[model samples]
Target chain A: MLLNVQNLQAQVEETEKQILKGLNLEVKPGEVHAIMGPNGAGKSTLASVLAGREDYEVTDGSVDFDGEDLLDMDPEERARKGLFLAFQYPVEIPGVSNKLFMQTAVNAMREERGLPELDMFDFDEYAKEKIELLDMRADLLERSVNVGFSGGEKKRNDIFQMALLEPKLCIMDETDSGLDIDALRLVANGVNTLKNDQRSFIIVTHYQRLLDYIKPDHVHVLYNGRIVKSGGFELALELEENGYDEIIKQHQDA
Target chain B: MAKKLSPVAQKARDFYLHEAGKLGDASSGVLKQVRDQAQEAFAEQAFPTAKDEDWQYTKLTGFVQNHFAAVQTSEEVAGKINAYMPSFPVIKLVFVDGNFSESLSDDLNELPDGISLESFADTLSMNNELDKVFAGQDKILAEPFGSLNSMLMRDGFCLQVSANKALELPLYVLHVQTKAGSISSLRNRVVVGENSEITLVERYVSAHEEGAACSNIVTEIDVAKHARVKQVIVQQQNDSSYYFNNQFISQADSSNFNTFFASTGSDTSRHQNHLYMNGEHIENTQNSACIARQSQTVDSRSYTEHNDEHGFSRQLHKFVLDDKAVGVFNGMIRVDQKAQKTDGQMDNKNLILSNTAKMDAKPQLEIYADDVLCSHGSATGQIDENQIFYLQARGINKAAAMQMITKAFLLEPVEDINNADIRKWITDQLEVALAKTHLPKA
Candidate 1:
């Protein structure tokens, strides 16, 4: 298994309100798991907690990623250790170029993996290859990071970053939220192109529309901070046709 | 009856009366008259106190209480300072202890036709242009340090570019301090004729780090019609030095002026820049980036006056304060009634890196014309935690992330520089400053 979580309980920082309650999950290598839920569910909170965001406090539970404690690392450390989170909203850094930002990130991950850092010339060529692979505009590397970019472009940029990093486990938190149909396809294509036997994905979304483009091996209904129901790809189709009201109601009644 | 002077002012007066003759060639010519008049004015005004509105934020008690004297520079100290200067490919004029060093400076004959660069004494002997530069300096000379500088200033350069001539190379003026408890005063005048262009870089550095010293400077620049000028001033003195400067810029019709000032080291300093738009269709740009750490205090003020029509101006100033350091910015844009169709914008941003750091900013726009467009704003805050987290999530460590963010913030003002080499040089200087900066993580 690439990631395993047992009896997970977490809350918003400095608050009594629990966001994640006894959430249990298991993901083997190369499998895509789709987490579908309604508003106020723990879908995003789970993503944030897994990424080691300080805003969320993991009150209980153990998360083991490839035999190592996942919660013991900083956000950057987790990133260096082959964990990637595509932010829902990419930040705009006015003066830092996209190339510089990605180069620093890539070099950091490489250093942790005991690989030599790429110099400027070599890194530019490397980034250019990834840009072409993702079919992104070449000028995107020259412009400031995410500054003045369209919503779709931002999502595509995040996906392009993920493609560059090539993490083993990717947790995408609503990557399709502000994207148009074409951007949705580009993001899906970027993910589909990068998937391999050793890579896994945990996709968190409010709507199942994104799951249609990037097919998931399994689908789970998240309600009241726990995974209440789990099924195969057919579950996503059923949720799309009926919506989360049915699953949420069934979980509440049970 | 002459007003009683403060102890600091009295020290300056006594220095002028007793020691001015040996330090400068100001015994004869126009410099003599200017010094005499400035001495009278300086004796009447005391150092600025906290009660003064302009000096409210920056405390100068320590600077005023200490006695700084004029000292002679030895040959060994001059050699040490000469070694400290950079070997940039430019027409360099070196000044050690406020006196021009013939051995260290480049040959003035290297300058092309229509361009003339001369020392203060040489220019005083040739023409009365120094009189015109000091015509309206009485108001400034009535102030405490302003008058003191005028009375004691002896050695600096006078640069003149004739009509239709452009200098192919940038001019560098390097001021180096070596003696402790010394006061170095300098006055420079720059005049660019119609349709001429020039780029000037003025840098201040210190070779002595153990003792306290002071540098008082006055510079006047006149831009003729259809002329252009770009000036960059970098101040990297020791932590024990005091720096006070005044720049008077006057622009004519269709002229352009751009200036960038960066100060990274000083115990206490004030850089005052005033712009006078005397003609229509003028363009003026001013930007500054300053870093203060420890108990350092940096005060910067820019006052631009649009007296004619069709003038445009923009100013962006940034500051990074750490430890108990303090930063102050006072910017004002005044558009007169006759100055119709003027456009101006001013913004000041402060990034405080410690809980004890403080920033005081006052940006004002006073426009009497109805058709002009003007806006001014100021923001002071700590590093954004979200920005930090965003970078950290991207695999960048917190320290590197903070540095990248801070550099981007400070370099935005100088992004429009056209010369890539000069821009990179300035960027390198800022990088060195960042290495010494105290950047606390959020």
Candidate 2:
């Protein structure tokens, strides 16, 4: 298994409001999974916890990634360890040029793998290839990171960043929310290109339309902070047509 | 018995008293009255001790005791421009010991038609109408240092540009204090004609190696209808010097005024900038950044007044305090009753780089107009740890990560500089200042 979460239980600060209650999940290499849910189902909280956001406390859990204690690492450490999260709201870091930021992140990941750093010229040459692959404008690299970018552009930028980092497991949290039709198509195409036997993705989304562009092997219905049912990709088609009411009702009855 | 003055202040006082004999007779009755009143104020206020509020952060006891006198009018410091010239192309004017040095200044023989650059004393003597320009404004001279500069008023530059004339190069005023133990006060008056545009760069530097030196300087800018003026004041005095300066600007109808201040030196420094928008549709943008290290301290106070309707003003100031250094900022924006439809914004951000470093930022807004947008905020905090961690995770070591974060903190305001050349120059200076902090490299 590439990632193993065993009976994870977590809560927010100073309250018994359990966001993740005894959740269990496992994903192996070369597999894609989709987590679908209604509002207040702890979808974002789960993603944030996995990414090591300090606010989420994993009260009782064991997360093992590639034989290492994943919860013991820092957020950046998790990133260096091939855990990539495309934030729902991409952070805006002004004064840091996109090109420089990407190069720094790439070099950091390479350094973790005991590789040499890329000089300015080499980094520029390398970034150009990825920029073109994503069909992103070359001029965007020179501007501040995500500053003054449109919603569609920010999403594209995030995907481009994911491509540059080349992580083993990419967790895209609501990456399709603000994208237009064309932008959504482009983002999906980029993700499709990055898909391979050596990597996997956990795409979290609200609408089933995004799943149409990039199909997932497993679909899990999350309701009230727990997984109510699990099925194949066709389950997404069923949920899209009928909505999430039947799944919630069946889980409550059980 | 004579009050025992510090060796430096004593020499400074002697120098100024000697130079006073050479000054031309007070040109106008108003000038004489103003000068006498200034002398009285200085004698009464004297040099502030540690108790005064304005002088609390910056101690001037040693500077006062030095009693340095003023420099003679004819004294000149040669060959000082080569090392300290601004990185940008500018019309250079050199002043030594508060007196304009024509030989060291750029050529003005073939004037640019309507533009004028001459000595204030000469301007007042040649044109009777100029007397009213400097006529005793007691309100402006009420401050102790303001009165001192007015009384000891020596020759300084007077720049006037005609309507619709936009100079290609920025005017650079280089004030060099070469004489040690001499209290030097330089006063400048600039008048931007109706519909004209200009950029001014004022650099304050010291040539003295050591000893006590104090500079009490004041500049008044008159911006007219539809004119735009950008002023940059770069003060890089010697680490051993003392300086107290004030800048007063009044903007008329539809004019825009932009001011940038960068201070990196001086043991103790105080800078005051007051902007008044007296006509409709006027706008002002003020920016300031200071890097204080070791025992140095910088105190900046600013006031923006909206006296007319439909005016706007925005102010942003940032400080990076390291070592035991202290930085203080007091900014106020006032909207009068008739100043309806006004918009004002003020923000001050401080980055404390050391445990011992201290910063005090107070932003105040008093709005009487009902239909106005006014906001003021002040924040003081250490470097963001998350930002630091993000950089470090990207292969930058802890030290380089901190440097990058600090640079980003200042760059927030530095990037607001409109001119490309000025922006680049300020960035380069910031790099040098960062280097001087002896921050460990990543």
Candidate 3:
């Protein structure tokens, strides 16, 4: 297994409300897994916990990535070890140009892997290929990170960043929220281009609209925190046709 | 004997009694009358205390109670500042110990047409033109620090941009302080003629690490009709010293005046800005950044009066305090009755980095005109938890993430500077200062 979570238990730091109760997940290399969920199903909380956001406390869990304890690492360390999380709401970092922010992150990761760091010109040249693949605006390279970008642009920028930092496991949390059809296809296209047999992705999103573009190997329905049911790609179509009411009701009734 | 004088007052009396004559002090003139009146006002006001509403948060006892003497800087010592100057094209006027240093300053012989930049003592002493240039500032002599600067200041710059001429190069006035336990004062004036345009940069720098010196400065700007003046002031001094400067700006009909003031050093630094809009359809932009750390105190005060119709002023001031540092921001916007259709917006944002850091923000708006739009807001907050988590999620370490967010906070105030070199210089200094404060470690 490339990424494994056994009996993950977490709660909100502010209210102490348990969001993820004994959740378990596993992902092998090159597999694309889509985590579907109803409202309050702990999809976003799970992403935050995996990314090591300080707001959520992992009360009990074992997250192992590549035979190493992922829970014992800092967010930056996890990133250096090839773990990436595409935030649902991309942050606005003013005064920091896209070029500088990316260079810092890319070089840090490169240093961890004992690769030569790219200078300004080299980094710009290297990023140009990724930018073109994502079809990002040319001015995005010079503007502040995520500042003044429209909703679609912000989502696409996240994918563009994901492309720049090619991690072993990419977990996108609600990446399809607030995205138009064009933006959705563009983001999905970028993700599809990056998917390879050596890397894996756990895409957490709502709606089956995004699934049509980037096919997933497994589709899991997350109800009330834990993965209540798991199935193949057809599971997403079942949820779409019948709506989450039937499955969630059946789980609650059980 | 007269009643016992306070330490600050005694120092002022010593300046008048012992050091005034040797410094070529003015006497038997209108400037003399102004100086005498300023002395009386200084005696009456003394050094500010907490009782004064403006100085409630800023305590000056440590900075002013100690006696500071006058010291002359050597030519070699003054020339050392050239090494610290960023690579940029501009007219650089270097001042060392309140004295103009020709050896260090750039020559103005091969200059642009309709431009004359000279020392205040050289230009103002020629005629009574000093009365017109320093017109509005003298009325504010009741202000103790302002009066102290007026009483002791001997040399600064007097720039005259002739009518209808536009000079592209930035005129930089660099003040270099190398004396320890010394008191230095500078009064400068600028006159941008009608329909003319110019870029001016006034910088305060301390070359000595343990100087513990005090600098009191006042600048008067006279903007003629249809003239535009863009000024940038960067004050970076030794952490043990004190820096105080007040700028009085008078805007004429349809003129524009914009200034960006960035403060990142000094143990105690305060800058008071007063601008009067005397003309219609005038626009003014004021941007300030106060970064205080390591038991330092940084204060920024702005007072803008819109006295005419169709005038607009936008003010944004940022304060970032870390460690045990303290930051103060007081801004007052007054729109007069005749100033109809005037629009003014003042916003003060503060970021407190540590539990020990403190930030005080007081913004007041007084609009006598019913047809004006004026709004003021002050917000004090720690680093946004969401922003920090967002950066950390991208793999940046916590310290580095805080530094990045703080840099972005400081950048918004000075990013709009038209001169790329100046903006870059300011940004680089802010980064270095932020690192020195160990803000990233937070």
Candidate 4:
């Protein structure tokens, strides 16, 4: 298994809010799993926890990524270990160029994997290939990170970064939110281009529209901090036809 | 007003009184008079206490008590300072212990036409311009240190660029301090005539490791009508030395003046800039970057006065203070009543790397002209934890992430420099400073 999460329980830092309660999940290599739910169903919290966001405290859980404990690591450590989270709200860091940020990040991963660091000229060439593949603006590499970028550009930039990192497992939190149809298609295309048998993906979203572009092998219904229902791709269509109310009620009654 | 001088001020007075005859030359007649008047003013006033409004944050009790001796710079000390020179190619004029060094300097014959670079006394004999520069400057005698500098400065340089001529290369004045506990006073002047353009760099390098020595330098720059001048002041003394500087800048009609002050050393370094927009449509930009660590203190104060119509000035200051260091910035923009359509702004940003570090910032704008548009703002805080997380999330270690953020924060001030070499030099300086500091994980 690429990722195995057993009996996961988590809460917000410095608060009594339990965001996730006894959630269990599993993903093997090359499997694309779509986690869909209504509002406040811990969809984003699960992503944050996996990415090692400091505010999300794991009370009880064991997250095994490629036979290593994941919860005990820092965000950077998780990233170096090939776990990537495309944030829902990408931060705007002024005075920092996107190229420099990516170089620092990529070389870090390279160093851990015993790969030689890229010099400035070589790094620029490396970034250029990914930049062209994503069809991002040439000027985007020179601009400060997400500063003065439009909502769509910021989302596209996040996908651009994900493509460059080439992580083993990618967790995208609400990647479809706040994006137009064109932007939505671009993001799906980016994911499709980078997909391979050795990598895996877990997509978190509230709508089923995104599922039309990039097909998910398995669809799971997340309700009230638990995976209430799990099925094949047909589950996303079923939830689209009938709202989350009926499905969540079924789990509540059970 | 009759008042007994404080012991510090008394020492300062006597020191100048003793050095007056040795410092004066026959051609510097007006400068002698100015020095005499400044000494009289110093006798009536005393060294300011910590309670004084302008000197409230920085404690100078220890500095005020100790007597700093003035010494003649030796060739051995000048040789040691040559290793710290900037890598850029320029006509270098090196000063050792406030005295101009002829043996360790480049040939002055290399200067272009319409430009005259020589010792201070030589320029004094050339013209009566010193009288005009100090005509009404005595009114500023209230500043104790400025008055003291005017009274005791023995040797420096005079650079004059005549009207309608532009220099092809930047002129560098590097001051090297080698004597411990010895005070060095210098008076340097630059005159850029109408339609002339030039760039100058004034820097100080000290060899003292833990000495109580001080370097007091005063530079008077006069930008004539329609002239353009760029000045870069770099102070990278060792941590144990003291540097007190007062820069006097005046811009005539339609002239443009630029100043870049980079301070990365000294135990107690204080820089005061006085910019006067004396004519209409003048442009003034002054930017200061202070990177201090350990127990050092860096104080930056400025008063930009827009006295004419259509004047514009932008003041920016960036400070990164760590350890138990303290950073201070106090800036004021004043628009006179008749100065209509004036636009000015002041910005101060500080990054405190540790909880023990402190930053004091005060940005004020006094606009008497209703038509003027002026703004001022200051922010003092440590690195944002969210920003750190954002960097760290990308696989950069915490300490390296903090360094990146601090570098970017400090780079904004030097980004607009027209000289790429100087900009690169400043970036390298910031990197060197970062290596010595360890930013605690946020």
Candidate 5:
């Protein structure tokens, strides 16, 4: 399994408010799992807990990534170990050029893998290929990270970083939010292009629109805090036709 | 009744009196009168203590107790400052141990037409414009350290540019301190004629680090109508050094002036800046950055007065303090009643990297003009954990992320420098200082 979460329980660190109550999931290599849910269903919280955000505390259970305990590592360690999370709201780091930030990140990951670090000239050439692949503005490399970029542009940038890092397991938290139709297609296309038999994706979203572009192998309906129902790809189309109310009601009654 | 003076103040006064007595018959003229008045002010207003409002955040008792003798200048120390000089084409004026070195500096006679750069002492008697140049002496003499500099300063620089002339190369003034436990008093004057342009860079550095050296300096600049002037000052003395500076600038009609000041050295430092807008439609920009660590303290205070209509000014100051270091910033903006349609903005931001670091910032706006648009803001914060995590998620370690953020914070103040070479030089100096800093984890 690429990632395995068994009965994960977490809460907000400051308020002690339980956000994810016994959430369980399993994803194998090359499989795309779509996590669909309504508002306040702990979808984003689950992603945050997996990404090792300090704001959320994992109270119980274990997260295993490629036979190693995922919760024992820091965010950077997890990133070095081939786990990537595309943030819902990309951070704006002013005065730090995107080229420098990415170059540092890339060299750090390279050092972890015992590979030779890429210098500025080599990194610029390497990043230029990905910029062209994503059809992003070349000038974005000279600008500050995410500063003055539109919402759609931030998401595209995150996807561009994902393409550069080439992680084993990618957890995208609502990457389709705040994107127009063309932007949505561009983001979905970028994800589709990166997908292969060796890589896996855990897509968390509110609507089923994004899943249409990047087809998922399995669809799970999340209610309250846990995965209430699990089914095949047809489940996403069913939930899209009849809102999450039906599946949520069935889980509550059961 | 006479006020009691601190040990440092007494030593300075004794040295000045002995020096004046030695001059005897040679010290006679308007300069002598000015020096006498300054001596009186320095005597009355000795070294400021914690009781004074401006000195509240900066404790000077330890500094005032040190017995610093006069600086000793020598021809042998000329080659010590080559490492600090930027690799660029420029006319250089080198000052060693606070005295101008004739052999080390570039030839002043080779200067372009309409531009004059000479030693302050050499031009004192021959130049009749000295009276108008010291027009702001009264206000400067009010401060103890300013008056002390005026009373003891013997050599510095005088730069003048004629009307409608622009210089292609920047004029660089380098001050190198080589003696230990000594004091160097220096004064500089800059006057730019109407419709002219120039760029000036003044740097202060120390070659010796064993004992503390003190540099007390005063600089006055006059910007005529339709003139443009850009100035950059970088102070990177050794850890065991004391730096005190007073800068007075006046702008005429339709003129523009921009200045960038950065200090990342010295155990104790203080900078006082006073800007006067004398005519209408003038624009002014002032930016400052300071990095202090290991019990060092950096204090900066600026007061700007807008006396005419349609004046615009903006000031941004930032400081990065760590390891029990202390930083103080007090900025004041005053718009006169007759200065209508004045737009002024002042902002101060500080980043404290250590648990025990300290910063005191006060931004004050006093506007008597009802129609002016003025605003002042001061903010103090540590590195945001979210920003760190954002970098960490991208595979950067926590320490590297903190250092990157700190560098970015310090670079923002100098981003507006027009000359690329000057900007690069300043950035290079800042990077060297930043590399030596040890930032605690966020």
Candidate 6:
């Protein structure tokens, strides 16, 4: 398995209100899993917990990635361990150029992997290739990180970063939000281009529109801190047509 | 142990007292009023001791004990004045013992229209609307050393740029402390007319034959409507001197003011810059950088007030302290309720290059306007260790990596300077300052 989760439970800081209650899932390599949910569900919490956001406390859980303990690592450490999270809302770091920040992150990951650091020329070549694939403006790389970018531009930048990092497991949290049709197509294209049999992805979304572009091998309905129903891609179409009411009712009946 | 006066300081003090006595009674009624008030204030406010909060970082006892006499007007310093003219040809004003030298000064005949640069004493003698310019402005002149400056000031520079006029060349004023052991106080008043533009460079340096000289100087700038002014203060006094300087600037509507301070001298120095934006649509940019070494100490305090609506201010100060030196920065930004839509940002970053060296940075913001955005932050730390290690791991030696990081820390603020020439000059000086500092281990 590329990612293994067992009896996961998590809570927000200083509060006993559980956000993730005994969530269990597993993903093997090369599989695309879609997690669909309504508002107030544990979709974002699960994504944050896996990505090591400092705010969420994993009260009871065991997350193992490729046989290595995942929960024990820092956010940056998890990033170095081939785990990438495309944040719903990207942070803006002023005075730090995008090129410098991306290069630093890439070099940090490369250093951890025991790979030789890319020289300036080589780094430029790699960055150019990824940026071209994403069809992003090359000038944006010289500007300050995420400063003054539009919502759609920020989302595309997130995917662009993911493409650059080339993580083994990519967790894209609502990457389709705030994006127009054109931006959505470009983002989906970037993801499809980077897809390979050796890597896996966990796509979390509130709407089924994004799943249509990036087909998923399996779909799960997460409701009120738990994944209540699991099925194939057809399940996404069923939920999209009937809404989440039937799934919630069926889970309660069971 | 009694603090002994350096022979040079004694001579400077004698020169100051002699000049003050020669002025015997204040010549002009306005001068008499200002002088009397300043003397009383100076006598009432004892010299700031180490216990004083503002003066705690700087020790002034060694250079303050000797009551130096102010220098009288002299034709003898003309040779000294001509020797130090900057390489670039430009109009120059030489002040010896606070007194201006006309023979050494450039003739104003060739000056552009609507601009006036003359000796303060000459303006006083002519009674050329001096009262209208400085009348009732005694609060700023009443500070301890400021009062001293008012009471003892004999000769200084006075500049007035007419409305809507832009000077083709900069006005360079050199304040030379000629005699050691002399307490010299110089006062300068500059008025930028409405819609006019000008650049003023004030350079302070101790005489070659320096002793324990104390220089207390105050300069006031009044910027009028739609005007632009750039003021650069360069202080490179003798290492054995004690210097206290204050700059008070007031701005009118829609004006822009840029002030830069560069200090790399004096054993103990304190600089106070107070700015008041009294009109709408005014903007102020203030930058200060200091490099201190040995037992030197530099303390800088600034207050920026947004008294009108739609005004903005930005301040950036960087300090590089090494050896047993200390640098202190206190910046305050205040936005009144009437100053709606005001935006203020202040940042003070310090680089401490030694274990014994220290920096104290305090940035405060007080906003009474709900529509205002005011933020102030201060950070004092050594260079980043991780950055240093990363550079060192890349085949660069530890010492070289440290030098690179330290240089970057100092250059960060220098890069904000808009003038290319000034930026290059400051960068070169920063390199020299860093060379004198001890690089930390990676």
Q: Give the winner by DockQ.
A: 5
TM-score of 2: 0.78
Per-residue lDDT, model 6, residue A79, is 79
User: In order, what DockQ does each candidate have?
Assistant: 0.72, 0.20, 0.61, 0.70, 0.75, 0.04
For candidate 5, write residues B357-390 as lDDT tens digits.
9999989999898999999998899998988998
Task: Give the true-structure RMSD of model 2.
Answer: 5.8
Q: What is the interface RMSD of each candidate, in Å?
A: 0.9, 3.5, 1.3, 1.0, 0.7, 9.1
DockQ, model 5, C-alpha based: 0.75
lDDT of 1 by residue, B71-97 (tens): 556335555654555455788888877
Better of 2 and 3 by DockQ: 3
lDDT by residue (B313-366, candidate 6, tens digit) is: 988888888889989898899899899999899988888877889887878888
| Candidate 6's DockQ | 0.04
TM-score of chain B of each: 0.93, 0.91, 0.94, 0.93, 0.95, 0.89
lDDT of 2 by residue, B189-267 (tens): 8889999999988878888766556677888899999999998887778877778888889899999999988888788
Which 10 successive residues of model 3 chain B have the least lDDT summed? B16-25
Candidate 4 segments whose C-alpha is farther than 4 A from its true place: A237-243, A246-254, B2-29, B124-129, B440-442
For model 1, the DockQ equals 0.72
Pairs that collide in candidate 1 are none
Docking class of 1: medium
Clashes of each: 0, 17, 1, 0, 0, 26
> Over 4 Å off in model 3, which ranges?
A13-17, A241-254, B1-27, B72-79, B107-113, B123-125, B128-130, B370-373
Tell me the whole-model lDDT of each prediction, alpha carbons only.
0.86, 0.80, 0.84, 0.85, 0.88, 0.77
Q: What ordering of candidates by TM-score runs from best to worst?
A: 1, 4, 5, 3, 2, 6
* The candidate that achieves the highest lDDT relative to the unseen native structure: 5
Candidate 5 shows a clash count of: 0
Question: Candidate 3, what DockQ?
Answer: 0.61
List, residue by residue over A96-134, the lDDT tens digit for candidate 4: 999999999999999889999998999999999998988
